[model samples]
Target: MSHDSPLQDLDLAAGFLEPPPRRDTYAGWQRWRAGRGHFAPAPRLTLGQWRALSPRERSLYDLHRTATHVNLPLQETPMSLKVSRLVNRRIRNNALKTRPSTRAGVMVTGWGYQGKTETVCEVAAAFEDAWLAMHHHLHPQPTPGTRDVHAPVAYAQTPVTAKPKSTCQAILGFFGAETKRLTLPELIRQLAASLDDHGTKALILDDITRLRMHRADDQDTLDLIRAFMSMNVTLILVGVDILGSGLLRQGHFDEHTRQWVLPPSQHARVHGLEATQTERRFDLVELDRFRYTTPGQITAFHDHLAGLEANLRLLKAPPGMLTGGRMPEYLMRRTDGVVGLLERLIEDGCQEAMDSGKETLDEDLLDDVVLSLDDPERDALAGEVPAIPGSSRTRTTAAPRPACARGRGRNTVFDDHGPRGQAHG
Candidate 1:
């Protein structure tokens, strides 16, 4: 192996250094689960060393840097750690129950850019990895004479234009099942059958808040989701502002605990007899952005910045480039302490630093990098964090947004105006 190339063994042209799997399909999920986490960062070189390298090596190093910067490993924050533990434990408990009744599901609710989906998916994928290994790559209890993929975790996204039939089709599609001519009932039946046939125990429905209660179809989809609990799959519903979405309108919110308490379904009224509320429970958890009010929170934020700064590949980068002095406070203002926005700002700053030949991040260099001001979370927090030097708070744009995009939601479950529900830090 030559010592010149940054990535000694892997060839970028041969696709050995390709990006990660899509994670939306079965094959992609399997590939993602099996893939390693590390990506070799481009070797940092002094100006003299850089000048000595041949043009080929320089190009390869640049290519490698591009890949490494964007594909930086997922940062585990306090919110992610908490959610992961809760989700993994619940899924494990649900998978063990042999009962015919509904297994308790979990609903993860938070603001946009809070990384709900990524946290849940990481835990679910890890569960599947351990499950397959334990089962010797076979379905633990296979259906008689039938050959089906043992997908312990079935992941699906709620369609933007959601309905009962469309939602069912999405889940069914995850298992590579056919739904061309199937009716709504047929689709649900097939979905249930597929879950059993494929030995799926956890079904994650991301962007679940898209099922608004105002629409008749969406309401029907909500009911269908409740009905799915009886099918022996632990449901993981991930969405933004789920409490405000009216998905839990059927339940009452308790002020004391700040949680929604569901009263049993009133089935007896339709049956012309007295009945108790359904005992189905969904453990609702929240993942919020970092706050700087408390001393502990401030320490955590500094620690997170330290982690990001440690991974930066800038050759001229000084220690405490992001963590020292007023940088953390400036970043808090720019990003509203949202992990996704913070990561974007840093990544863009890194790119700018490399391109501008600065090779170091500072307040002035990051000023040129603009993040989406349309972010609802950032917009909401703008008033609280006072403007600082080189912060987006101080910078103003004269150009107005177009008419079509004006008054449009920047963060909502029904549309993809910005980044999808993915974790950045």
Candidate 2:
């Protein structure tokens, strides 16, 4: 059999010809021949390694690995200098004082959206550890009376019918003695007792208005107030402006309560002046809407903005800069001098920007956030105006015309005196 030329051969062979190598295989062969290093996939990180990463590094890793990078939200939001300093001073003073008294507490009151709740929560968290420490130090042991009651009874050197025992049992615990499960009143009493036992000199009740409102009975609230007052515990009662008005109306509180109404200026003065021989105390530091700012304040705000920007950059954000230099001006106008408003605006603005995948915050975004705020004053204004269309016109008009007289050619209306003569009066 004469085989066809190799180029023209066409055999119907059942066995398949050797398959050509894949492109990757050839590339691998070439790489191997060239003695070039092979590209190995990056090593995977274990959970422990991931956990050990710093926040900044983690943020960068997330950005590099994913198209959508979610920022790690801030835990402790920034607060107004005024609010911060006031809270700090109050907490420090109360913590350091020798006895608990009503005057030692802090009272914060402002309109809604002014960060009243946030302020309270922040203050609580800031001092909670210290409060726990103080609580422990004060109630180290049960009272002698309670201990004596626990002694076993004896009858003629022998147990006789197990001497009918009293039903009441004194409960002892780490905190103190409790006759029964503690209610609010019992808890307050126990806390007071513990403080008294430990020489705690200060007490802080954030939104005392809530307590007042919940305990509507004037006498009951008054009694509680008196208990705090009698203890001479420096008390701080924080609430909205309505709190001041409510306290004024309450029969229990009078000029004495007003004495604790620390003005913003006093707050500023105290913050400005360190403890001097004559002053020797922390004054109320008022955060001024207009004045009372230092270069440090601006620096602090800018630093915070810079940190935020750095986080944004890790997400591969296009070069963006925060122009918060005008933040003070923007805050002043938007908040209308309310410290709480300023803080909320800043916090909300950041959240809004992050939500929208924005790397930079502009004035428009801030204005939108602030202007959308609910205005309580608007509600009050609506209440003052009547709904009738012509009511305002009627109110603007002078007293209705008295009996009018018809003149020869013109109709005339009367003044307060009576009907007035027309053309020939």
Model 2, C-alpha of 249: deviation from truth (Å)? 5.6
TM-score of 1: 0.84
Each candidate: what lDDT?
A: 0.73, 0.37
lDDT of 2 by residue, 1-425 (tens): 12332211212221112232221122322222232122121123443544466665444333332221122223232444466567667656654656422343445554434455444434444454455465562433336554221111000110111111111011112223463664544555554455456443344333333332322353244334434434434444443343333443423222543333321222212223212212111222222222215665555545554554544422223333443455544444454434344445555665566556553356666655633434432222211111211112233663777876765653223101211112110
Question: What are the runs in model 1 whose C-alpha is more than 4 Å off?
Answer: 1-7, 10-19, 36-38, 44-48, 253-277, 373-425
* Worst lDDT 10-window in candidate 2: 151-160
Q: TM-scores of the models, in the given order?
A: 0.84, 0.40
Cand. 2 Cα-lDDT: 0.37
lDDT of 1: 0.73
lDDT of 1 by residue, 4-26 (tens): 64446435333536666766678
